[model samples]
Target chain A: MKLPKKVKINEVVLRDGLQLEAKILTLDEKKKIFDQLVKAAVQTIEFGSFVHPKLVPQMANSGELVELISENPNDVKLIALIPNLKGAKNAREKGVKNLNFVFSASDTHNEQNVQKSTKDSLSELKEILSYCKEQDICLSVSIATTFGCPFEGEVKKERIYWILEQLTSLDLETITLADTTGMANPQQVYDLITELTNKFPHQLFNLHFHNTRGMGLANMMAAMQAGVTSFDASLGGLGGCPFAPGATGNICTEDVVHMLHSMGIETDLSLDELLIASKTLQQLVGHETPSYVLKAGPYDRKYSIPTKK
Target chain B: MKLPKKVKINEVVLRDGLQLEAKILTLDEKKKIFDQLVKAAVQTIEFGSFVHPKLVPQMANSGELVELISENPNDVKLIALIPNLKGAKNAREKGVKNLNFVFSASDTHNEQNVQKSTKDSLSELKEILSYCKEQDICLSVSIATTFGCPFEGEVKKERIYWILEQLTSLDLETITLADTTGMANPQQVYDLITELTNKFPHQLFNLHFHNTRGMGLANMMAAMQAGVTSFDASLGGLGGCPFAPGATGNICTEDVVHMLHSMGIETDLSLDELLIASKTLQQLVGHETPSYVLKAGPYDRKYSIPTKK
Candidate 1:
């Protein structure tokens, strides 16, 4: 059970977490959550996504939210999710310095998510890369459905390798292998990550998992065992894939931090402040979020002894 | 990770799962769930507890349920939980062949749960052992709060070792280290189990975990890595500690089997049948259970590709 001494969490509650919710959070609401995240010492955050207003109404205010938060003098890296070159340009114009380009590894899922084949998405990534370079913006890539796909099912390691080979040659800050629908098992995560890290030792990889099947933390443990230190998690475990049927929230940020801190792995994030942010997110969502730490508190929490009757 | 080729599951839904529900199930309904568990090819089941009827109204029918189900000619081992010699005698009167004596490793939790200190419980175990021997009933023991205690906090490994030292001398079928409040983390589980297995090489040990903190599956993975082959899981993730505040369900049976089967580990249980049993439990309880596989199917389930517009 050898694990890393420290790990990095990239909070994505604002973008991926709120994208599927019916209630559209105003810029003020998003800013409130942003301030809480900053108070929690979140090093990097996916603030929002640059998508069409009609396509994803909840994230239509991504540009405005990013613009409002970018003015703060802080070192917290603010990223916006982009599906194509237009999304990247939109985020850049709004002063989002960091952009994450996402596309599914499976052709069927890729087509369903972004209306383009994996090959076409790769071609578009080239243009997005050149555009980001011209705009002096940092870029990353998220290969969704790297483990399995709802439509196609059982995505192969070769497909992930193929996608990574194309993206690795580009000037990207990181490459995230996402279990988009929470279809990944621990063994598969360990094997794929072990191979990927060994083949490309210098490439920085991030893992994004969902707790849809109750394997989120286990998969993260496997990824850590395979030497991955960066992860994408949503506060209060708020998020779901619209295309993936019965999809649940992403691996929760508070729960992940709880596990890591329990196991003596440092994340540099304040658990108490994270719980405050999680409570705020739950209030904003108007529903119970799938956050275990919020409900159960930390493992070290002590209760008073019951007096004998 | 090195995992066993085959793992054994001791289903505890009948006893622990139902004990917490406000809606007490009828004898016929309990039989239905038992039949479904048998249909799923479950080898071991904790049928019910022999506590006082008034203490646990939900399990008051334990005597009747055991009498009715034990008559069926099957190889499935039905075990009853007992907190003291009185409960053991009561279970034996109903013709239960297997009995599991439960006490907590933490003195405060033991006192809260059973109105006795840990030392008193160990002393009572001697009488229960003799009674079981006289009745020719096979017996095991479950040590609650082996990881941590809500009241005392951080139940030390020295305490666990001391408890096991007393129990290992007795003729018990197996011993279970239970995270009664879901406070056990993976590193602690791995380190403790590894050390225990090394020290007590001949003792058969089982792990009981709760998903209260979302570390159930991860802790199970860590235990498996430490060479444990048997576990206690509840169907639909049912069960919680009545005394442990904010306790959630146990590690879900269907979810555990789903993960093991996905990792190429065998449990000799039909996942589809388990899902059916889980669905029955959910309906019988008239609420949603915290089952991941029940809500999101197995990982191998494929969805049809949507036609392009």
Candidate 2:
């Protein structure tokens, strides 16, 4: 039940949430949500992506948002998602202080998702990490489809380790093992986290989960047992796997925060403030979000209006 | 996972599911579901409750169903629910060889549920266990609202132990901790089961989970780690608390079997066969069931019809 002194939650609303929406959120709306999120005690946030705007139009305003996060960099850590060397260079030129790069370990998914072989991605990662070190910018590599691949049935644990070894050799301590397709049951979560943490005890392992099979929070509990501290969650359960199959949404930040704070886990996140931000995001997108606690309210909130049957 | 060599899945369709039905299930229809459940390899079945017929007409057919199960005594084990001394005696007179008697541990729930205080129910349990011992009948006590109570909120872990201690003193070897309203989360499940198993290592423990907030299977896994092997599940997620506030359905047997079997955990029950019985029960009741796995099929089931948008 011991959580870190201050666990950093990397909010992925702007990039992941907006990309999944049919209606693209305006730059002003995204700014408002990000601004509210920072006010709610979130120190670090993944503001946007460096993907091709043609592939994901929702990320067309990445440069504008990154500039905004940098201006108010007093207490906030800003990060951007990079798909390849092209994305990494684009983010570095924008004076990005922190970057998150993703590559799938499942060779089938590595070919299908980013159209690059795993070995090629490793070479590209080595090149990018050298530049990232020169620029003194923090780097984290997310090994996506780490749990199970839609095309390939099971992603071996050893493959995940080799990918981590390549990344960790570059001296970046932070890494995320994402259940991109939501195939992680608690057993898988326990086994993988246990293996990685035991091998690389000094590295700060972060977990990113999706709730497609309704095991999002369950997987988190397993990760916590393995001493994982930081996690990634999208506001309003807004992310989906556009390429991988059956990933409905990322774990709702508000729900996980609520559960953690209520259980004496010391998340240091404001439940009421998080709820307000989630509802605002829902309204900004002009659609109901999948966050249950946001819609249902906390246990003490007596303002739950009785529904008219 | 090491499961029992010959596990008995006690189907709760007739007793648990129809309790909350707006329209009662007839004896003939309930018997048909029971027959189908047996065909599904459910070797043990909780037929019905021997409560006041005026209070619950849905389970008035307990006597008849007991008679039906008795005819195939070698093929299956039949259990009847007894709420009080009157119900216990009535079920006993019907020649039921096995019985499950439930009483709430939370004082507030005990008052609201059975109109008796927790101590009063404990007194009554002593009376009933002695009666059953005299008749050479098997008995297991279940503590309703063991996870949390609607009126009492969080029931203490000590309360569960005290009750189990009392039941053991009455020479009852088997008891179940029923998550009556599904407030049982994984941490709570782990804590309570560990405490119970540590205190009474040799006593047979069982879990009764509700899928209300969608943690039924996760809680089951936690309990399994805590050394719980036996469990109770109803077909199609049929039951709810009569006095409990905003309670959802029981843990669906088809769904539970599917999850257990998929994890290489042997349940000694066929998931596909349980699903067929669940579908038949759903049709017999002429309503949509609460089980998603039954309608959506198992995780790897091909040819799934897309859910309506």
TM-score of each: 0.98, 0.83
> Judged by TM-score, which candidate is best?
1
Q: Candidate 2: lDDT over CA atoms?
A: 0.76
Q: What clash count does candidate 2 reach?
A: 0
In model 1, residue pairs whose N, Cα or C atoms come closer than 3 Å (at least 3 residues apart or on different chains), thus clashing, are: none
Candidate 2 chain B least-lDDT 10 residues: B299-308
Q: RMSD of each candidate?
A: 1.4, 4.9
lDDT by residue for model 2 (B1-309), tens:
222333335677788778888788777788788777877778778888988888788888889777766786346888888888888889888889888888898887777667799989989988888889999988888899898876667788888888877776667746878888766777678777777878987787778887655566667777777667788889888887554333447877886776666566677787877778888888887877767565444545322222335
| Runs with alpha carbons beyond 4 Å of true place in candidate 1 | A243-247, A307-309, B243-247, B307-309
lDDT of 1 by residue, B202-269 (tens): 89789999999999999999999999999999999998766544457899999999999999999999
For candidate 1 chain A, which ten residues in a row score worst on lDDT? A240-249
